[model samples]
Target: MGQAAPSKDEVARRLADIGPGEEREIGEGVFMTMHRLQAIQPLGDGWHRAQSTEGSFSVELPLPFNDFRVRAQATDNVEMRTHTVGGKTPGLLAWSASCLARRDGKLGPEARAPGSDKIEVKGTPPVAHSRSVDLDDMTCILIVEAQGSDPVPPEADRLRFLHSLKRTGRPAW
Candidate 1:
């Protein structure tokens, strides 16, 4: 017989323990690879696969950071934001949409709210990367912020998470 697959809880613990500069699988065919930045430590607390309660879509997130910082009138459009935790810069503000066509411009007010100040990361200030992604039936908007001189999380990390957004085999109609 083959070895049994790891449970979800076990996967979460392993992802946390692996820290930065390492890759951990958060779900079936879903893997999160942490990138290292100067002066920043690795992240912990693992990742959880977050799905809309209505089963419209699914994505991955680091623990304790799943709260939506901003949301539209329609609950399907939302943005999950967080501060730096466990030594790792929390560079993720992932948005999910049930209908990309109907909700493209209705997500994250913070993303729409404009102006950004330069923040230091690895001793040098870099502008935060705010980007949008389209995943077939879902839409993802990613935002990474740098408060004052604090370092912004890497864009690669945000992209990784954004790309992981997938529809959960449910019709959005």
Candidate 2:
């Protein structure tokens, strides 16, 4: 027999209690780790920095903020890391992106141009902005979705979030 899944409240509780550098196993072969920024500078009022150590990138988000390094191991040595923030906060947008590194550490394909799309949700139409940055050995694909309200987030907010994304360096793992 298998164990019952956690309730929504329980899941929320766990996520709320997670602190910097703490890691939790949310699924089989998938791990989530909260990150701590080495240095935090004030971008503005009511915003915080979210960094992914494994992905080696950082972005800024509004208050009531947190970021997680989600690792899904496919095999003994193959894994992918996705960095995310603000998925559960009402009235606030969410950001989910991933960085992929070539094992050979060579320059890959040219980075794609930044673009935007409209996604239909239950209550409103969310806007999705996507961009890619090519590093020495990796490509970071960033996609941020603004939704959960009629007007969605302001265009300035979306641009700020997207423009704040920075590649710290190559992935550590």
Candidate 3:
């Protein structure tokens, strides 16, 4: 004979007991860290790295996600640059852009980008490309454009930049 399954109310109660921004062990070795808007589930095998700061935000990336250079940083903006390999364009690059709206040292909703329209400047030798996405509390902008007549970067480079972004926290109300 096996133990009876928990009732719906019991399950609800158990879930309700978990406070916001709390970390709870959900499996034999896995832990689920809760946030106001997201839940971070790190690997039990120790392959994930935490990029969290006290009372700030948290983000974990896979082990292979590395080798990036800090291109710019400010009180509200952070940009990281990395290049792609095995592509036709050897110098193709990507960026992880995070522009936060901070009020009283807490995150808040910022101006959202209108849409993802691939805008290209006319009459320019090198192609000028720009795209922006609204990340709830921030706006992530990625620009892969002309660099002194350099050939347009491969599409794979832009995809890599979009896939590399990981948000650790939620936007403020």
Candidate 4:
């Protein structure tokens, strides 16, 4: 006869002890992989460089952050790639990319120089900054949003996050 299956509690205990960068089979044909988050390295004065999981872009954020990537269907033929980085402290940043082909091969009228603006909302932070860049057939937008009770992030911090976005010429999608 086959061996009895492990108890739920026993499986939980085994999973609890698994270390990062490790993988284990808890049951027949069932595997779990543990991944360690990339370290957020400091660049002095409360700023750190946050890189996308795909290494396509990097931006300077005021605090340690965790980032994730997502892909969504934008249209029948185009998909959107979104990379978001946020910290527990007080800000959220994201980069989004989509094919420029959807826009009839031209930049939209809103595609102006990168800048910051004040957006007043009753119970939310009032600052939103964004910039758009065109790379080959892709259009990428970088946005930094203020969070928490503060009316806005420090001017320097907001600008740093907005102006520090760098793309490595890699395809975002």
Q: State which candidate has the highest TM-score.
A: 2
Question: Candidate 1 residues 103-136, lDDT tens each?
Answer: 4333243334323222223324554444455444
Candidate 3 on 74-165: residue-level lDDT in tens? 33553222111111123433222333433323222243443333433324554645545544444444455444435655666545443444
Tell me the number of clashing residue pairs for each predicted model.
Answer: 0, 0, 0, 0
Supply the TM-score for candidate 3: 0.34
Best by lDDT: 2
**Residue 14: error of model 2 in Å?**
6.4
Model 1 lDDT at residue 39: 27
**Superposed Cα deviation of residue 29, candidate 4 (Å):** 26
How do the candidates rank by lDDT, highest first?
2, 4, 1, 3
Weakest 10 consecutive residues, lDDT, candidate 3? Answer: 80-89
Between the candidate structures 2 and 4, which one is better when assessed by lDDT?
A: 2
Question: Mind giving the per-residue lDDT tens digits that candidate 2 earns over 1-173?
Answer: 54676677766666666778898876556577887533344567866676765667777765444555777643335455666543324654555556665343443333333332232233335466666665555556666665555244676766776677777876776
Q: Give lDDT for model 3.
A: 0.37
| Model 1 residue 173 distance off true place after TM-score fit, in angstroms | 6.9
Ordered by TM-score, highest first, the candidates read 2, 4, 1, 3
Worst 10 residues of 4 by lDDT: 95-104
Which sections of candidate 4 miss by over 4 Å? Answer: 1-39, 88-125
lDDT of each: 0.40, 0.59, 0.37, 0.51
Give the C-alpha miss distance for residue 169 in model 4, angstroms: 3.6
